[model samples]
Target: MAAFPHNRRMLLMGRHPPAHPCEGTFMSFVENLIDQVARATGLGDNSRKFVGVLASYIFSRPDGFKGFQKLFQKAGLGGIFESWLSGSPAMRDINAGQIQNALGVRDVNAIAEKAGVPGSFIGTALAGALPLIVRSVTAGGTIPNGLPSGLAGLAGKLDWGDSKVTHLRGNRKRGSFWRWLLPVLALLALAYCGWQMRGKSPPLGTPAAATAPVAMTDGTAQSVGAPTFAFQHSGGKVDVSGTLATAAEKFQLLDALKSTFGSDKVTARLDVDASVKPASWLDRLKAMLPGLKAEGLKFAFNGDAVKLDTTALPEAERVAVSAMFRDQLPKVKVEGLFDRGVEAIKGLKAGYSASELTEALNLTTVRFDTGSANLTRSSQDIIRQAADAIEGAPAGTRVEVGGHTDSQGDAARNQLLSEQRARAVADALIASGVPAERLAARGFGSNRPVGDNSTEAGRAANRRIGYEVMR
Candidate 1:
């Protein structure tokens, strides 16, 4: 929908460039373009290097460049590529949806897995750089032939660090000064604009002070004190202390905390002033029971504060808990909690029955790759903890590793995938010192979904590996 600049040189280059000295030229152009994008997007050193790696991988695909062009055109983002090729100083902004559309969800997930970065971060980096990279490589207006066919070959030929970029300087054959100078100037201009806008913008993560009473919908002004909240994580638990004007507000805060820190890991002590009636608070908290239960979180309001505890959770479950709170509730002061280590699986009673161990394992978060039987790197810790618990279970107990899938593709395929996933988990457990004879793998497919298959959240919930005791 947006208009973009068009490069005359690219228009003449066609769809594929011939193999010649320009191979290095093409590679150099992409390297420079990546550097420019990194500066523009404010990517850190590691992420910037990742962008280079991703570019090499994409280009190495048999039809990667052409595929990207087609994908962009299909997603209605052709204009961005046009603008980048035409050397437009203004970068076109692309959203996460557009990135997902341009690069299929599966491909994006694979890229995220291969890059070892969050999918969200991958989307962001690609959105910022993909157009420019495409434009640079196709500058002669064609996908260059004789390029490396894989990331290893491409990376071997290219330098990722401070080595200077050479070749692919466009029509000018002599000087490289203008080519380097223009991007630097563009970056400075963008930086200056950002600085000029900073004064008018409110600081992030700072809560506004409540100076006046909040007016209620019932045409009444509640004479309430200012709301103050703080959260901290230590010894495998998050401690929340806060004061809110009403019980509804308290419930809202507690719900967010529970979602972020996993209800089992959150311990809240919140106070609702006497100005708000107790009945109001009780009703609100009661209504949230189902949602809390679904998330496996615990909530209770004590005399002074809302007591929340997540100390029993594994480390992987608590990942990104603090970030979620900071991003969603920036005003709430959080201390001693900046994404730390996971709490050892404590509180598992010795000599616990197989069923009890299964229930506890269900509470732990175990993640796997999208559409792959391989367990995610993050799931290792959780599986290890489960193995420890299983080892402690009664001698005759046998644990079932049950895999389930959302109703997305064919039922037959889903069934097979689920079975493979279940087996993968069993294999992992066996490798981690759990006796192979004590564990069995089973797949339920989409038949035994615990949540709705229509919604993404429900689908995520349904696609899980469940542990069941089958003594």
Candidate 2:
């Protein structure tokens, strides 16, 4: 419905040059699909509604799977729908372009001739609707980001008009000045934007009075005193004592500071008195998830003034706690500490005491298969339970995925297999939206066996995934 200007240059990139249309042009795909579906359904009103609604859906879904199943059911085609939405590996590679072509056709006759379906069936049941049905994918929007495959090519063929030389040809090319200056201009623009977004607040630990220092009235200062920070949660409490000049400054500290990797895992509480219980400040902590795109980087924020009470973790994870903090928290900062503190923390991590590492080493594990790293269907529920339980763990807590195997065959082979299994499980957890740095995968093979290698049940128990809480 929303017509876009046809960029003749984009059209030139098509396989047959002027004969083919621009490849993977989203707007054209939607427009063409709407036209085809309208013709195929024979119900003019329904066809129009379907096109408008579906186009809206496609545009809205960044991952391309919003309301896919329901659309198919509405069109009385649910069987093909199931195969697509279930995330089957084969289904993951489906092309949106193919469906677009199918939807653009006005007559079922076109599809019937090409697809081997009967004319009577198309006329009565599908009519012109076959193209629309094809356009409405069962896979939702899992189309791979690449040049068109089978489906895309088909759609292009349907949507594109034959060659017209005038539009495709161009005499002028970008000038040398423009070409060289473009990248430099882009870099300058990026630098300016980054500079604008730099920290507005003073360096961490600068005297609180220098910036947003709180102002206290003579009477209120005498009675309630200055506001302070408390790291306490519903189940635990750790008090941070410091004087801020005003409530406004205290609010800024509470809202602005984030969690640091090496910093202790402490909850924030805004308390009037030490005797009063601290309330949960979950609304204040800052953390981020990975991007849908593979190339995107992961970023996290850790607050200052809070340090982990390391004694609470399991022994294994406690060992590596120093390393994790040192390796992961370089860019992270606390209020009093600027980047210097981050460097100091990194130094401390290298020579972290045995007790510190032991405390940090605490962890939990979930096992996977032997030779194959894929998760069994039966493992889904177990993983779900584990994910739920780990969601609320302390910031110091790190999850280690240990893959175990029964004592059988060559030790080297078993060890390799186990490691791969652990990595696979770790990948799945990351895919499920867990932080990658918080997880580490290792294969222990038969080295850390809990049961005798002779029996089947014992072997099964030996081949398990174990989880431990880091100190």
Candidate 3:
């Protein structure tokens, strides 16, 4: 393998000489030596700098001469040391820090102070040798125990604050040293990566191993200036987050989503449901109910049901707007302005289909008493048409024949008269073979006025019967 720049520095510093009789196998020698030093010093299974430091320190040590010579001889590069020594100072300077780091001193100044080098040259020598020095002390297995006897007190002072002593004693098990010293750094690095990757997808477990970020043209990846609507699926429900700026915008967005995701995919939430006034296309026509606005309209889709949040939209006009949409939109899907991926509503609207209603209800003659609950001969045809209209309703349907009267007498008596009239109509249906279980009679005595009670046309409109589906 080709030598790295730092490896070449190690070679220049007399750290990685080839061995004898290995016949030009410098690469093998370097690898084996690194492996041995790493194992002996407990750094082989760890970081890259450990080996670098070990090599520099061993080469720089005075006693290391014969050891390195043997290493060179073994690797068949014994003749290259003199040639390596002639290299530039840059190589020396870089390796110096490696050695110093290995030695557990902060930098070259501490090493020089320990070595008693003073004056301008001390800085130069320390700078050049810092890497090697650090390597030597740090590589020697925890604390260096063999300082000169004369410096025992000073060495004792160094030992008091020394991490190596505590680490060696406390970290005796295999892999314990790295577990004690490096795990926190590794964990912190991992946490930083995780924070950066919050919304983005991470790899199976590690943030550092995450997939590359994807660019979303429609701004799904990140929220820019535009509104971001996202759905998170959990349990059986999907929580929708983010917002639409205005009522019309909210409606448009909701309409688009209902069109794309089939209204069943998500439940919508809004801050102000009843207070929003959704603008309509007819607002421009002042002559057709001018000054009216949708002031309190708010809505959400929850699976099969679209719920209106009316608490915020407390105004009458807004309430009407909400009711209108609630009553109508479910019948037909309306594609509005903000159509992105919207297509169409899936099926025909659900309500009273004329064919189905006719198939369920039986019909014959229907009659009403003249100005009372008494039967009359002329009213049979209109009653038959009403029965035929509801004939197709399902078997369990609780059909009602509701009656109303004009303002003619006391409120109490009028109520009784209208109720009797409804019963008369219901009896006619029952007589004509409509099942009694499916019929109900109700009466409103001028309570819900469809037209003015003072006019003849109004009275005619008030005296009417209606059918409703109540299944």
Candidate 4:
């Protein structure tokens, strides 16, 4: 195997010859080494400069090297970094998506901005060069305590020409003009031959009749711009129109509207636009709506504004829903409906059985404050009714209180919160004259959402308390 040239090895190892002193900071040394390697690898000047800047930024961070190693492992490119460090030829490549996921969107964007490169290019370049850079800094196997020094002398030792093979027979006389002229003549001959071939090629920009454009049907042509969606709610009825990006989104939106308002009360005329791709940020906004529906309020998303219709809801519910939209979807403007009336809760029978009481509890809507396990004051009346029904059940009956949450936060944290909420509700029921041993509390977190978690209404439905009765 051919060994790396002496100067190349020295540069990779961050060692300078005896004549030069280590005068600059650790970052400067890293930058210098990066520039050399980037140029050697045939990167353009701008890309090479950016690579050096990016490397400096990466290595400057605390735990930078360790963090990159962890990222490599997470992204399944650990072997690539390992191979580069071991001086093996088995280094692997990484794709853009893995890099994006491993480094996180924020870090990737920051690096792109600092490097003055497109975010997409940064991932490709980093994946291509990071392994080699890491290998050089670590020096074969072990990472040094601090950055390597004495990189300045590397410039004087580098040879940009092909490797020269030494003859062993005798010390041959060097510097003959004829020896150089032969290679130059061969290069000129090759260039002439290439030029001769180029002259035979067809002229640039000449059209080929066989490549004529074909007429496309109107339906096959691309849409001019992104499709628009408009929603309007008045009284107890909701009307949805305009275009939806996917058939699935259209179905989901209409289903949610019908589920929240009666099927007859909602009407939609939405067209599916295959040309428009769904925006991720818009999807997140759409996810916030299901919870609002659970509160007896309706929203219509139109352009940059959202019209909130609370005509069929009580004054308290209207205020609460408005606050929620303001907090969750801060970017959109909120317009409220003037009409208001409280929707009465259907009362339970006086002598309901345990099973009937459990069924009633499932139908009842009990709400809590955002991120809090504490039940809202308005929910106490519903809880009291549930307590009364439970008290009327047969003697020696047991009840199970289950709590859940929407899938909007960390799963582990959501699980913990759900458990706490369940316990809190169970405690409330116990304080309302139910026997302590007769009740069991459990949390399902966001695992058992009654509706789609992708919408606010669905999350709201998920973030609820459920009851089950056992003998």
Candidate 5:
């Protein structure tokens, strides 16, 4: 991976202008996550760097912070996490054992690989560096919607206090010397690597060894900008997450999943959001579960379209099965060129920008029912223009639907509303024949404001939705 440029100055969060896309044009999504997390955590230790990779995997979701918080908080470490941000000396240090315990040995080892470090080094590095990390992200006590970008002029504007914890535990025990210390250090250095990997812990486990023959994941399918899924299946275990269009669909889908995967193996997170496009593929979905007997097989479903992913199959098999699926599923519109690659969205204009698309969308505007994602008739006609503009800019463009709101009511509700509204737009585009993979949706709450939040007009403007071309 090409390393992002680093300088003496750190990008601290405060009342600065929103970070613009043009600022860091060279960065990729995962790389940006790594860079931001690295910057946020002060790049304390190489082991700690993997947290950036881990963060990328989790925070890639439309509302990523939810999973990020759940990763630790669900492990019953909420208070310990809080102390890390306490900004006092009492902030505790975790051990390699704790990192193993929290993330599990398997995930630690996998993260070690991603970070390009030995497995043993990761646990200790995180144990030593996480406290400083906690302080950086919660800087000024706000978790940002979009990843931070600009770092040029916005330094020292907000001097929110940080954790008082120091990295080196230099104090010596009453009579202890290097004699005792060296042995303990050596043990930590070697022991973590020696331990047998325990696969698949209940908490945010990834890449664990699974003896079971079948591992399946069923989650919400979304575009690049909205609430997408990140699933880990190992040792015959299953994980289900992401939002759904309706409760009935969730129930039917869960039943089919449990029946096929065995009830004991299935774990699910099926959130219901009315704004999601109602499942047009559900009638075919139940029948399809039985066909998941093959490994490395995945499917992407959007609206009525159901596309099979045969990337894991042999080249001949991949081509043959895709043809079979194409014949079976009429809505899939499976294009061989896009099997694992990007192609231009048909009819999209060339070199479109978000600002241009937003303006064009405004002319024919897609409007939702007040405070809900339900589209009015006015929104229907705009999908074609919006869809084309989305993928029109970059070749093989992937776009995100960013939902915004002006400050009006509860901030939390506003955030959810924005997400729903974004999805609604995305759904319309998908139903209108834009490729499902190219679009994503997310809500920005009231954090981004165009006009003054106090004014009704500004709030209305803030409650708008826009698109971004993601690389």
Candidate 6:
């Protein structure tokens, strides 16, 4: 639901906008499946309750998945998630311990109490049910970012608020595998028929490709009104409406929109909240705006994830733009990001030497908030992956963590900030299990410059965390 007033020039975009009403049917299916899973396994009386709680927690807030993934990586079980993340037909098996590591003890205990079960029961049920939940909901092997089709409006009706540690409480009496089996089979058949008929002659008046579902968070209980941005492009006009954390960021984004599309054609409904922290993708989005002029496009930024619909674009164009956002916002999820022309790139190999680790780390630098040592959300995956690489380094090899600042501020303060930033990264590494004795933290301040200090890009390059093999 978007509003655009004041300018009445109607857009001639295709009839199919990004709306799907049949979503509740899909959610009902999920509920039934969870009930069946619990009863079939005979785990316990409340097994179904906790499993349903976790599933609802995931469905409503997909961005928390980054924390889930980071937890797995910290526990050295990150690779086991590849199958579910990739939406592979057969998901990898997980265990109670792995689930425990990912959800943590406190959260599990909270969900357990809500479900009237022990913490161990929550972990054990989730271990069996998590894979099922992931694989079943994935659309076309790519996870969809928003709630299931039509599920947004139904979230409250469905009792999906588990915002207390985000673990919702609910009750379900029964699920018949036999009853649910028919609908699942029929949908599968319909999907199969559609696949078999791909590239064949189409019926008259084919609908424009379905745009990605738009789930604009209206600042839910857990969302904390943390910056939301969404735009829809159709017939040469753009309609935007979302909450921004700052007026400055709001102005910058609106300016970017005007610059991309003519100023007169932009219709915006943006609100600014100075108290909330700005979204991590704001700058990248402003820079990427010009390239998003594709017809019939929809871009939604909710919390720490993005859902982009390029159905109106060709394979090359869609894949290129999607991949660009994907690379730039590694810490955020890009839903079902187009499926064509993308080749998987490998990450750091095991048993890396200190120099090799430094080289790899440099390729993707860790960034912090302006004038502060707090790492931005976008730097999280880089830190997580770096932690993994450092853990795999040869024994006795020592690495130094160095932070630098540009020449924009007072040199003394810059030096102090640099030291704090370096120490922050070192502590993060230690938290991720990199031994403290094997690492050293230091600050270069404005002294070892890698890029020109006068320009913005150069300053960004200069203000970075660098790694070196300690001699």
lDDT of 1 by residue, 312-404 (tens): 445454344433322322222222122331232456667666776777777665556568897754456567777888888888899899999
Q: List candidate 4 stretches off by more than 4 Å.
A: 1-346
lDDT of 5: 0.49
For each candidate, C-alpha RMSD in Å? 23.5, 25.5, 28.1, 23.8, 23.8, 23.7
Q: Rate the local accuracy (lDDT) of all candidates.
A: 0.53, 0.38, 0.39, 0.54, 0.49, 0.60
Give one digit per residue, the lDDT tens place, for model 4 in 1-471.
122365457667898533321222233334444554443222344544555444444434445456557666777767655665533433443444566777777777766675565654565555445655665455424543222222212222222122131111122234443453335334333432332356543111111111211111224333354444544455545555555565455545554555555544554455555666553225545565465553334454544455566666777776566556555654444455221111221354566667766776776655566777877544555566666667767787789999888899799999999999999888887788777888899998888888999887787668878888764
lDDT by residue (222-276, candidate 3, tens digit) is: 3233333333333333344433334334434444433443333334442212232
Candidate 3's displacement at residue 438, Å, is 0.6
Identify the leading candidate in terms of TM-score: 6
* Model 6 CA deviation exceeding 4 Å by range: 1-288, 291-299, 304-346
- Which 10-residue window in model 2 sums to the lowest lDDT? 288-297
- Residue-wise C-alpha lDDT for candidate 6, range 194-293, written one tens digit per residue: 4335655321111123232245444544356567778888767777877776545665676567667764356555656566668888888878888888
- Tens digit of per-residue lDDT, candidate 2, span 1-471: 222334455455552323222222333433444445533233333444434333322322222233334445555445444443323322111122233333334433444444343444333224223323333332233332211121223222221122111111121244643453344334333432332245463211111122221221223222243233333221221223343433223333433332221112222222223332222222233221011011111111222222322233443433234223222333222221112212222334444443332232222223233357766433443354344334434455577777788898899988988898888777776776667777888889889888888998687668766544444
| Of 1 and 6, the candidate ranking higher by TM-score | 6
* lDDT for position 329 in model 6: 72
TM agreement with the true structure for every prediction: 0.33, 0.23, 0.23, 0.29, 0.25, 0.39
Candidate 1 lDDT (Cα, 0 to 1): 0.53
**Tens digit of per-residue lDDT, candidate 5, span 1-471:** 332243112233323332432222333222333443443222324323455444443333334444445556767766666655423334443445555676667666765566665553455445434554454344334443322322211121211123121111233343454444344334322322222122333111111232322213346434532322223344456565555655445556665666777644655555555567665556665675565544455554444444345656566555445534443444433323122111223322566555555445443334565668877543443465456555454546677888888788898998999888888888888887778888888889889888888887677667777666565
* Better by TM-score, candidate 2 or 1: 1
The model with the greater TM-score, 1 or 3, is: 1
TM-score of 4: 0.29
lDDT assessment of candidate 3: 0.39
- Cα RMSD, model 5: 23.8
